[model samples]
Target: MAGVSRYLAQSIVGTLRQDPTLNPLATLRAWPNLPAEALKRLNQADLSLVDRALEQGGWIWEPTDYPDNLREMESPPLCLFGRGDASALSTPMVAIVGTRKASSYGLAVAEFFGKGLAEQGFIVLSGGALGIDAQAHKGALAAGGRTVAVMGTGPDVAYPAVHKGMFAQMEASGGARVSPFPFGTPSFPSNFPARNPLIAGLAQAVVLVEAPAQSGALQTVAAALDLGRDVFVVPGPITSPAFRGSHGLIRDGATLVEHPMQVVEALGGGMIQPLPPEEGDDLSETQQAILACLNGGPMLTEAIVRQTGLSAPLVLAELTMMELDGIVKKGRDGYQRGL
Candidate 1:
């Protein structure tokens, strides 16, 4: 079995070196000792059919180099089908994963980590699943920082399909969509468990925002433990089933993370200077007005309009611009100072 593991690992590395378009996991799962029975029950399928479907979807496969560091991670995916520059994968990254059915609190925590990590110069990683994962990716990209989506399905096909535009936007903004499965690989239940390890391997740590007792997100926590990487969980309402798995992990010894700073402190001594306080780009007058409105705590757009004397339309436009500039965030009721 050790021989099989080593060979399987080597096979992926070798495949990545040759066919840049190849997704090692999809093809390599065919090997003799790949825990196929378990994965098969999970409904995993090969990518041969997926490749053809993507051709009709107008997707293109582009090869990019993986950093020597990433290639050296324990059993890294054979190759990743990337929608943008693969180099973004090499950035210091932290994985933020959680339940698909998330509470409002859980979603907020995910976004906090996303924006915080991006500001701290850490690339954010997530599965691009709905709920928590989606919020995290949105926050990171909103921070104007690098983010990578590791898919359980093919990079060409957004699994939920609802995230299709988000995926394209990420790629266009120098962020990337990556997969260990070939194009058109329908997101099988089985594919995600296998995909968990890849996410754990890519990150320095895995953060479980909110996981139900039987959630697949737990698989990632387990993989992180196996890989000797740190695992962190945000404390949620004790009564919430969404927090059951995470609480179990904490009881078993995962770090309890509340603020995003805790994560940064865990990664290194402390957060490095995140995105510079200000980029060289000059702020527009309207953007300046909006920032002025957020003098202290989170502020609503109505308050901003009243304070800035700007119309709602003008205030909203400036707010969007500030969000893209990484200056502000939309909170539960309104906008707030973002990381």
Candidate 2:
């Protein structure tokens, strides 16, 4: 029986390798249940191939029996490839996913949630897509924490060519890239919806930063609810199409999240202390003056000079310090108080 299970697992993987769109669920469901299916799938592959490709890439298994909750679903994937530590999946995980074309506001939320979640020891799960997904992964990485990048493509295939560097960085940082797809599969639109389920399922809750009505991130929210996970939507400018979907989700009963700590509390971590706002709290006099100039909002260099009453060289030095302190935000427009 064990041998048969291994054969099935191997065959499924091999088939998917050649064509990821092959009905993996069909093949999986045929195997009595997910556990037996996973065992067979693994046995079908070369031991070395499985070892090398998935050593740290998590597992594809079914629970021994239908977990009552999961079994009640329409048709759960026969098996799933869990990257990183599965135990981490069971921990308080928050899925921070949003638009691939995100606004600065979206980026800020992703970073804030990533850092806050990591600091509180909760794992962050997200697709490894560019934009918001990348920002979320980066946020967690920047905080020296573990995150999981669930892939729509193969773990070995970095979907956006440019993110190869980011992908390598993620693996190097004790984070893991995961996918239900086998090695070397190119990304497909269909695969993304398939991948969304895992991202939503693995997390205790889902956080939508900025998603357009048609965005794939919203699909993740649907999956989260189906999996019985909590869903939180960050409200954004109602006028922005980027926020349309999130607002709709909120109207439909998704929780609203104004801060990362809200997500932390939702996951049972309770309220969190934001790293003390150090801008004014620990600033040198010079730094304070620069901030004072920018506090009115974005300012031109000349405007800053007039406001601070400081020489160009002096103002530049102070502004640099304030920038380094994260007290000021910089952009093409000019500098402003870091929101």
**C-alpha RMSD for every candidate:** 8.3, 8.9
Off by over 4 Å in 1: 1-74, 269-339
| lDDT score, candidate 1, position 178 | 76
TM-scores for every candidate against the unseen true structure: 0.66, 0.68
In the range 135-204, model 2's lDDT, one tens digit per residue, is 8888788778778888987677778988888877777766767676665556666778877877776677
Query: Could you give candidate 1's per-residue lDDT for residues 47-165 as a string of tens digits?
Result: 46555644544233322355654554576665566567566777788999999998767776787789888878888899999998998998798788878888888777777889988
RMSD of 2: 8.9
| lDDT against true structure, model 2 | 0.72
Clashes of 2: 11
Error of 2 at 59 (Å): 5.3
